[model samples]
Target chain A: MQFVLKSVLISLVLVGAAFADGIKPEALSKDGAVTRDRHLTEIRDIMRGGRGGYIDFGFYYTPSREQLPLESQYGEHDGFAFNHHFAGFGAGEVARGRHMGALLWFDRSGWDGEDFFLFPHYNDFSLQRSVVTWGLTFTDARMDWTIAAGMQHQNLEHRGKIYPYEVDSLAYSWAHLRFSKLSAQANFYRTDWRLFRFSLDLESRAIYGGKKSGPLTYLPNVSLAMYNADEESDIDSMRITWEQNLYDQRLYAEVAIDLNDTWFHSAALKFYPDPSRMIGFEATCLNRVRMKQLSDDLVEEESDLLWGGAIDLLFARFAYNAAYDYENFFGAKGTFLVEFKFNLATIDGWLFNRGAARSAPMETDVVKQFDKNTKQSEITPMGSGSGAPKTIEAKGIRYEKAQPTATTEGGN
Target chain B: MKGTMKKISVLTVLLACCLTLSGCLTHWFVDSTTRLQIENRSSKTVVEIDILSEEDSDYKVWIRDTIRTGEKSRVYEEDWVGTFTMRVRTVGSDFDIENLKLDGGSEYMVLSDSTDGSLHYEFK
Candidate 1:
């Protein structure tokens, strides 16, 4: 056994040296220009550096609506509701060339009083939701591999003004291989928790054909997760989801089922006109039956089906999104979101241009001309004398140019 | 039983010797044949170096003068790894190679970053 171990160590050193020798010293440059293929560079850039932090604020408003049939006599008055959300995201690479980075994210959202009252009286309390997430990612360009591990905390308002928090830990990794006319990717993800649930998911993708024709397609994905309230309790159940994309890039569908004394079926469809715009609709039906452990006698329960739709639009420097969701047991809820984004450096350039225009000095030129027909005093004809005022044409001129335009330099 | 044990021990010793020889031979061939070529074409002066380790760590870099031709000399030395950058600026017309070197086992070379011509280096 010792001999085998020694041999393995020696082999590792040899392989390391071989790889090191492959590094072309001449290829090093300080200009930050990597002499790799376009696709490879794209992947490398995504994993290379990390961003500091970002502040995001969002507002959503949904009008009151109702669910019909089962609760025929129930009607909720039309009311306006709003939510404000704030988040900060940051990440950094700790190890050199190993492609390792850590990410931290925090988000908080609150609902307005008017929106809170739209629900049942017992549920009429202001809501505050917050989440904190931390993750570490490992990336390798040569091997085309990336791995990430993280944990998250989610808090929601409960029972009037009380807040309850749920914690979850997750680990995920993805590997992508490139070929001449095709590519494949494998992804593994797992999340474990006590308050919420624990789940494991594995996904694979084989992409063939070109961007336009060969059918940009996908198939159902599989996942197995356990849900329970607490330890030592037999209230555990398994949940599964299957999804697929069809009809070029125009449609997407998914179905989910849980096997814990409850039957749930869900279907969704997405319509995408182009790369930047999409509309989607989804519905879910759920029925809960009494389990032997909970109650010896089986009883039939009411079935609930919920439906919703959403629209998303991506613009040059802004995005617009709207969604409407309705649950049979609750009232209808909707959200409208608008986001405006611009690079900090670009804004600085705009401010500088404005300042330059205000600080510029204005000057005008006046020219005296001699026209023989319009001269008030005796004037020489063309080429008749040398001392006469040179014939000149008066033209208006501005000393300053207009504000600096957005020059198309260094554009992607 | 005693005879069989003796025979097995002898065979094992012989096999170990043969495997060791083969491993050394493979390492020799790999090291001798591995070569990396770099072409520098930039306006700034650049020092090219290789990080020859699987471990992610910094390599020292510097310059030292090895050969002198008239007023010119070749410099080779190890440079500080943290302060080192891929590109460096040249002050005069002459390319002073003796002023830069890398302190470790890795191979490195300095060249003018111009597109007019190509610079080549051979490692043995």
Candidate 2:
């Protein structure tokens, strides 16, 4: 653990240094005319930070899986996992994972789906567990409200060797698999008092391909209920959430997924306290605190608050993200992500140091000195101006005019 | 019945490829450091020179040092990029430099002491 932390710190310092290397201190953080520079009118527009969504490719090294075990059928898996967080598309995000996969909707009014490809039997290639789905979604005008339902198909393979016994476990099997169903969803969003915001999603799915459904064994436990391959089953779920933001969307929510098929709910709150994306904090609370328990025989069990955060950086063409997840069941897990996200149009120059997208270096300039008795220029602050902010050149950094702090009526 | 899924698989793969090909890298790659520096230009070394930012009437010090004449002292580092009110204090008197905008640039607040014991500065 110490090694991981140390390595991350070392990487941060190295990356910072690498980016700072080409920067000539005297060149820019711009020093423009006093009236314009003091107002800082262009901070929000600095480097086009908040424009379109970006496509991010990350290589993640996960060392702990007590909470959500990875490839359990295999050994205790802890290694580098290639992760693709695809955004910049229409409204939905299509992400693929090997052991597990899901495509979620940021704005449910759009289309979305989830397809999981579990294991291909070690001995038999044909006997594999997989679920595939494709569907369109509906969203409201505010963008906060949406509805989406995709085709949920599941082809679960229970080979004689894997299930050894006739009836293994229902919840375990259901997770590694899915059902062929037509899914429908509806989500409503509301923000009250401008601080408390919540959204609720209602989903109903109809199971398909339930042939002469096979043998069915359900434990008395509610969490283990499942439909016999011969019976028809569907999943109806509801999700309730409350969230807030801070620091101009940088350091957001500082406060705080699932059940197999029945009515399950989960909620999460995350904060990026540092606009630089170097530091983050988050806490999550979910309904199935029972399944992820450390022991099954506990007399009293309550939902758990799974919390985690990350420090991320992008410099000199290299991107690195380090995160720590604190799971009561898993204790603590360390994960590090490394990868480069490049624009398809600029891929040729993305990795090349001399690439076309590279920034031009400036000539070193001298810092002038003032002699005794020389009258200095008077400093004047720029007040409310009718002119739009102008982009200024600051040797190494780009900057703009500053504005007077606004007077917002509510919230601290 | 599972044919629908198979048919979409081909489309999903092709769409994924197109999206990947058009991915973007949007982080700012500008190379610069932020600092507020003050260089003493007078022949005689000045003792106890301080720089302060007064926002909302609250006084926050940026640079505090005994600047040897002709030398420079960095009063603040990673200074914010925006409007600001500043003050330069010398052993003799305090001078107010009001409403200076910083566009994330490195500029020396060159200061000179007049015979009347007043301090004046320029962004050199």
Candidate 3:
């Protein structure tokens, strides 16, 4: 681990030196005014050694929960053991030019071992994994073009508790093209694995009716295998996707299909009023058909259908996401997750903007309004003004201060 | 026929090169670098200095130190010296100079005789 860290640092220093000697201009002057050379001196003084990065640390523990079988009552056997996980992420960008920069990132996560039905014999077990990524990006502001290439290394846990001694490497390249009313990007990626995998993705966008109408976008992808572990396997697949924007760009409906032996199709609609607000619904079905011959020369076919939906909400810097999933193999299961994020800017020197701090009053107010509307049982004055509170009564239950425009909102 | 084709290809390549050269020559210019400083008055210290410029620009800055602290009735003299060239633009940004050691103890403790120990600078 120390060797890898040292190598990365040495490489960064060498690359930075090479880039510095190749891009800096001899002097800077504009028009007839030669702002005192002091300007250059001051600029140089300020541009030296800027460092910024993020650190995240959290612990999660899930207590064992009871599970009921389809035909039997709830079992009392010891449930899956509670596990603890830790993760860290760090990234830094070293500016090379006004529009060009180089970035390096390291991410690592690990968890203490817990019992698994599949590996029942194991007692105490643990897993550790980490990934390091480095890349350089160049942007041509005048031409609205950007190009980036990066390499990533993943060290995944192997057998027992030790991670893989040899790290897997992946390389990716991407380019973006921008136009007055349209933009497009093409990306290519390759990973070195037992069975090498590569992918190519293309996406395009078209603007209509300015920002209010949102942009029309389409993405179509196709990948071909250069090599596979099993030569008998299929070598190509294609996917087509389309999205229609509604309510400005806040809401969207999308449909997509993947064409292959195990053909899959799905359709989803989403409403994202803002980054902190969202509602979505989706349905999907996958068919995997195969022919089997019995000893008596009999043929049979089997199929399965899986579908689910999820809803996520973020308020006051806290996010709650819940999902309901069902499968023929696992029956029906529900998952809920809640997390609170600490805003580093709140404590950093850059927290204030023009002497005003960013406040979450609107977010808090919206959450409270939703909670009150759902729980209120008595009519009460909303407020004293032209837009005074409206009373809503149903089935002898009165909801005070109900908005006239209150409507049922539902999505997946 | 083959010889004639080769001659035509050569001329086409030469024309393309001439056009590209002309385009580049019309818009070649130098870029400038920016310097920024952050002073902490509460702490009477210089927190950071950053030099923002292209990677290849080779330049250096001179920082003069004038700080005094001590008894008002006594005569005192302070001399500062040292020159450092800017290197590595990629790492360029706010740099803390409090730890920079000079002929007179630590740079952060220099102040005028009438004032408390404080950070001061003269950029050139």
Candidate 4:
């Protein structure tokens, strides 16, 4: 284990050395406010992807659950009230030409209080995932049709306790098929009748030696296959989504059905109060369909409902969620989350462009013209000599008049 | 236009019904990675290094094994973030550094031996 960890550490150093570019010196020249904001924006870009590519960093915590009576046959296991501490980083980028993209994420969840727990019984784990996508976009004057094929590889260092029957570790790879269509009407923002944008995504977990660890197993359906301990692979899922936007508001609906014998439906309404999308709010509801095994011989289908709301402010977001007659694996009811994210690619283009403008020096000609106009405007009159109309031809200049004039030209 | 609006309204209601009728269990959260490098300059070999969170002192983000004297440790990345402090333990002495800033990116620290048997440190 030490050797493996050392190897990973060496790889990280090599990777970091190769991409040693950190914050630009100019950005750090000030009190580092630019550096901080840029970091936040870069993380945001990773989540939503506006700046082509980004390296993301974030932290989240989920409160511990109340103690519950254990009925395991082994012994009375200490269900110590331990909170979940998670930290991870992901980097991804899609080419500007929409031809290819790749993403990688490393996530680690540590049980903070269980410091000295013995391994084999209680172990440490990490997950690394890599995905590559190839896409093609067909666009005409009125609409865009996009199709993509992708593959994702997932590696788990140590299998969690949830999957008890699993061996020491697991690795699997899968394929994805995605298609979408955006009508010209949707882009026009017309109040009149128009077709909603539509998209569909499908994943076949059965491909590429699905769930590679255990013996080869086959199942009948995706739903039932998800829960079968004997059949670890050969599962699939499909999702369909429809979206519509009207000026500052958007409506989205989606349904996903998994071969693991589960289904999910969700709908969301989002409002962008400002044109920049720096501040926005969204209300969403989700419903899940599950195939639960109630007894050794009996199985049943169950449904759960949940609703949530989220608010995004510049570089941060807060969300609150509540489940209806539903309990999580830990029996928690509601969750509150705080996140720092900004997608310079989504709707913060203007803001980031403004930042770019601030960092980038002005052209010499523009600066000279600006200085000349400012110096002359202080002494110049609205109408020079005899109240005739005046035309100031200074580029990039704005004139504020005290009174209305007959005619004005040149200056903007 | 009115008919289209009516259809959309009905579709929206149907979508809501779908959400109200179906379900699963999920919790969404994002975790961050933090990188740190330590250079041990003390004459004594260091045993363990503990990284404690500022918000929750009891929380241990990482417990590193050992750093021999005059040895520089490689950059270590952990699934952790937030403001933190460090405690370095040697044979019979321990050193504590408060308010250590690790900007969620990369940080380097150099620990040196002092004439009076204390530890001096600086961040790079």
- State the DockQ of every prediction: 0.00, 0.01, 0.01, 0.02
lDDT of 4 by residue, A1-412 (tens): 9999999966754543333221111111121111221222222222222123323333222222112111121111111111111112322324432323343433322222122112211322211111121112221211223222222222223432312332323332222222221111111012221111222211111111123122221111111111111233322233343333433222222223332344445556666654334466777676755466778899898877667677767555555552211111122124344444344321111232111111112376477789987986564587666977676666787888676553455465
lDDT of 2 by residue, A145-239 (tens): 22323332333333212122222111111011111111112111121110111221111100111221122211010112111222223333222
Top candidate by lDDT: 4
Tens-place lDDT per residue, model 3, A1-412, is: 9999999966754443233211001010010011111111111111111112223222111221112111111101111221111222222333332244444434333222222212222211223334454455454433434443344445543322212333333333333333322333333334322122122223222111122222322333222222222225433444444444544444555554555554454455555544112223333333334355554678775554433444433211111111112211112222222222121211112221110112122565578798888766555557744786686655677669866553556443
Model 2 DockQ vs. reference: 0.01
Candidate 2 docks at the CAPRI level of incorrect
lDDT of each: 0.31, 0.30, 0.30, 0.37
In model 2 chain B, the worst 10-residue window by lDDT is B23-32
Q: Write the per-residue lDDT of candidate 1 for residues B3-122, one digit (tens) a residue.
A: 999999999996564344212232232221112223333343433343222222432223322222112223332212111122222333323222222222334332433445432223
Give the poorly placed runs of model 3, Cα more than 4 Å off: A1-98, A102-112, A115-128, A161-210, A214-237, A275-303, A315-334, A337-412, B1-124
- Relative to the unseen true structure, what is the C-alpha lDDT of residue A334 in candidate 3, on a scale of 0 to 100? 26
Q: Candidate 3, residues B1-124: lDDT per residue as tens digits?
A: 9999999999899656434422222112210111222222223322222221222242222232221123111222221111122221111222323322222222332221124332343332
Query: What's the lDDT for residue A250 in model 1?
Result: 43
